[model samples]
Target: MRQAVRSQFTAQRAPWALHRRPFSTSYTRSGYADTLRNLRIGSHTRVIFQGFTGKQATANARDSLAWGTKIVGGVTPGRSGEQHLGLPVLPTVRQAVEQLKPDATAIYVAAHQAAAAIEEAIEAEVPLVVAVAEHIPLHDMLRIHSILKTQSKSRLVGPNSPGIISAVGKCRIGFQPLPCFSPGRVAIIAKSGTLSYETVASTTRAGLGQSLCIGIGGDILPGTDFCEALAAVEHDPDTDAIALIGEIGGIAEMEAASWIREYRSRAVSPKPIVGLIAGIHEVPGRVMGHAGAFTALDEPDAKAKITALVNAGVTMVHHPSDIGEVLREKLQGGSSSRQGILSGLGFGSQRRQMSTVSRRHRTSAQRAVPQQKRHLYLSTAQSVGLLIETDRTIRSGSPAATANSQYLVGVGIDRSSRMPCIIAGHPLDVLSEGHLKRFPFDFQRGPVDIPAEQIASHLGLRNQQTAIDSLSRIIKSLVTIFYEKEAFLLISHLMETDKSLTVVSARFGFDDAAFRIAGRHQQLHEMRDAAAEDPSELEAEQSGIVYLKLAGDDATVGTLVNGAGLAMNTVDALARLGGRAANFLDTGGKATSETVKKSFEVILRDERVRVVFVNIFGGLTLGDMIARGIILAFEELSLTVPVVVRIRGTNEREGQQLIARSGLPLFAFDSFDEAAAKAIELSRR
Candidate 1:
């Protein structure tokens, strides 16, 4: 079987790109998994768009068509008899289904409108539904899940997703950048879009083309998760390995790790799984850029996530750039003819090359640990936890010629108390920016007493009285700036000759909040590059509500939600239903009923908004408070325009009751889908 595969591969100039891909799959196929054939989207899979004629849909369609995807047609309400991007457009999914008989429907609708579009496809019994929109309301997705359970015909790809792409099949369903992809035997499943792109690019360049790449979406709740994608890949005959990219958020990575471990245990020859877990340096209790890029205090961080994968027999990597080289080292570095085929594809002597260099560098650094060292400084707007090896982190540059060099020092504030505390001689010689994981000398918040003698003793400055005094004065200034200017300071590169002491480099970081506050902070605020920023975002920041005016004139629904995650979700829902939001307004966790009224004023400030969609989950802010605020806003603003309120959680029933009796042109809904549908309906009117 191996000889036959090699013979077929050797005969063809480009076996991967050729239509006759007659490679033997006997080794990788363990024959123990049940997966949908739809998981591997093929070149022949006919696709239709849900929100066919929208600007975003048209633009994405152009890209898909160019990428050789089988785009049959699309569905656009009120624009049924139109042609977009050389494809026929219908009014409804059923109409497109009846005409095109599409294998899948790629939903380009807004997030708020996603439930309706997805439901429409499910009703049409489309085989697969790919939702490209982000931030579909969690409530709406929960309902979508319930409805999906009622049937098995429709397999959903994403709500906040980039969608699924089969590089070998040439079938592109989502909005993935097409140029970086190539046809190969490795399947990719990632929660992070940017990382997925990097992996695809890296693997493709390393002559390890991809079979399929699935972006499961970085929402708190994705439509199709890692386990499902993994099952599908495991069953795929084309795929020989897997790249699972997860992050520090939910238990999704842990669950995937468990599944991989269990499956590998039972299989005859399980495929190699290379895992990469993102968000290693994120601050605790803070949500990163992505909606789901957050970890609970009790949940596992990056280290734990990585450990689970490694325990599961998966080769895990810290960065995406390392994935391809590692995969090649695992698969094709041996003596077998098929294994040696990688050399033909230009992966000749570069396997494990970097790791070897890294090992050598480590050995050299370790040897020099006791001989020489220099100060290192690192600080940001937020305090970061770091594991600094005083010896290893020394600059690779040749150490200064001395029996004993300078000690490393870190000058920063204690995150717990926001006080200035300098770590001296143990690793301190000069003022430098860096943080390490450990308890050390403690100091008070207001004024840190850094005497000249203490500096001399800690930094080993030979007690040069004037130099010590200057360093002491600099430390005092840094402490003053830390409290008064709300700044983070780190001074480094202390050049000390027998006769002289001079400061070489220094970095100061200002707190963003300080700029928001009035007075002397205004000078720091003026340093901002205003032209590069979005004006609406700045205005929203000033109003104490997080607001971002979405691009495109088609945004008709003004979105209002409590949390940033939910706000993006609402916008995604609107897009899913073929509607758009004028702006993203997060009323914040501290919002009151009055905040809702004011939020309405801000939403109304966007003249494009025909209707306001208030989708608030009353976890931090109560539902009744949001509802009461809606009524107040309707009265205060004399809002004749429609308001669709989908408020759930604490006192949700009371909130719905208030809206029912107030009778202020407001549509209240217990179900998020129903409310978003109503908002899209009213937005159209």
Candidate 2:
């Protein structure tokens, strides 16, 4: 492993000052059946598709099948017994389940229909269901997740994900570019599909092929999360390590960190984990980047996620390009000091490619993306490869992608020596606030300070006054986009030529909230491509609800609390105690019978919800009213699911007495622990 990585990095960089250390070298191979059985994906797994006859599905199916994947059959309603894409198309998942007995089903239905498709797959007991649609209604996801909790037989990969790909297994369930993945020992689990490819490219470049790669999806609450995927990878003997790539929003990274710590304690020889979170991700409500202009990552959410993983013994790197090198270092026990170039610039050793010069400038490989699209919003290295899928075989005859006259590098352009070079979001404006996560570098409230010499050093260029001036000017324009457009991330490939620097390909990620703000950004809002947006998400916003689907298969309890904070707490406490919550419903402090009835109506919509836990602490609301409402709603909805109510504050005793006299199947308690315990017990029963 050391030799492979060392030689690879050496080939990319110039001579380096040598350092020495000793390390152990050990490796183990994996088998088809024993690997990823929890994820229900393996070498022999028979894969099928839901909505297989749809336009997008058909196109992807063609590409996937051609990539040497085992596609057995599919499910397309009203097309039963029909053949599509040279595979049998059944009318329903149930029919396909009965006949084909596929190991996994990749859902390709539209967002509105994604939940139903997943529910049908779970009902049919398909071992693994990978939902490919993005932005399934939050309520739909909650229902599907609730249904999943009823049984231990089914697992869901995504609702808006790239899906799982096992190069060794020859099973490609999602829509990841095929050329990017290679068969090896590392199982990569990434939140961003685009960044996952960058890691794959990096690891593969180091000659470390992947055993499996699972994109848990970019959704805030995906069906399968990092912890689940990490645990699943743990069971795969062939996977010796993990490349965990996450974005800057949510507690997924933090939770995964907790799991890693616990995992370290249990395993005799734990698999090495290397994590990389390099972008300013845009979640629905929060944004990551800039000073007062952005939701600074200084808030514990972003920084803590990265810090947690690092503290949990995850070898965390700052860039995707460094994943392979760090993985090699960790797997080799880091007892061996690195030999080749210092990997400060990441891009150098990852693929050893500099950048594309202007087409008129050179015949070296060059790709031109359509410049007409207004909002590209590309996430990371992965999104930049959108144009790359078409160019599989190009630019072969070169020592490397780098050029003697051309330098390809990405930098944050700090103020050090007039310009400190770092990398940041889609638009270059990320340098100012992106450093909050790495306070040791720049704890200040502005862009970092570094000299042009440092930027030139990383890119292996001589820092001359003219060159420095040119770079400063170019970087300033890029940085201006952040404040102007509220761009949180920037993905661009820039190359410097004899005349000037040119951007061959670039993509930007503007904050979602920026569009909502009035004034200058309103034009950006107008430029929004509704056709490309997730329809279900738009509908949810129109309903004035902040519903986000969370993923957990063992969650069985349905939580209906008075506020969002309480709803979240109930769900968290339930999970901490080994109880899974079906959905998080906030009633907005209403304790009336109508509110209760409405809540019950929504909760019971998911028939798999075996127990409903009502946790309401009265402030302005009366506990007695809540109890009476619960009883009324129970009778009105004809709900058979057991109810566990924990109400406190005003008239708490009255609420308990009311429930006791109601003679309905409801348990009212003053203690939250007891109520929660009862809910968990009923769910299991």
Q: Specify the highest-TM-score model's number.
A: 1
Per-residue error (Å), model 1, residue 220? 1.1
Q: Where does candidate 1 have its weakest 10-residue lDDT segment?
A: 356-365
Candidate 1 residue 89 C-alpha distance from true site, Å: 1.0
In terms of lDDT, model 1 sits at: 0.61
TM-score, candidate number 2: 0.45
Error of 2 at 404 (Å): 63
The lDDT for every candidate, in the order shown, is: 0.61, 0.58
lDDT of 1 at 375: 10
Identify the runs in model 1 with alpha carbons over 4 angstroms from their true place: 1-35, 333-685
Query: Over the stretch 539-583, how does candidate 1's per-residue lDDT look in tens digits?
Result: 555666766666678789998887554554456556656787787
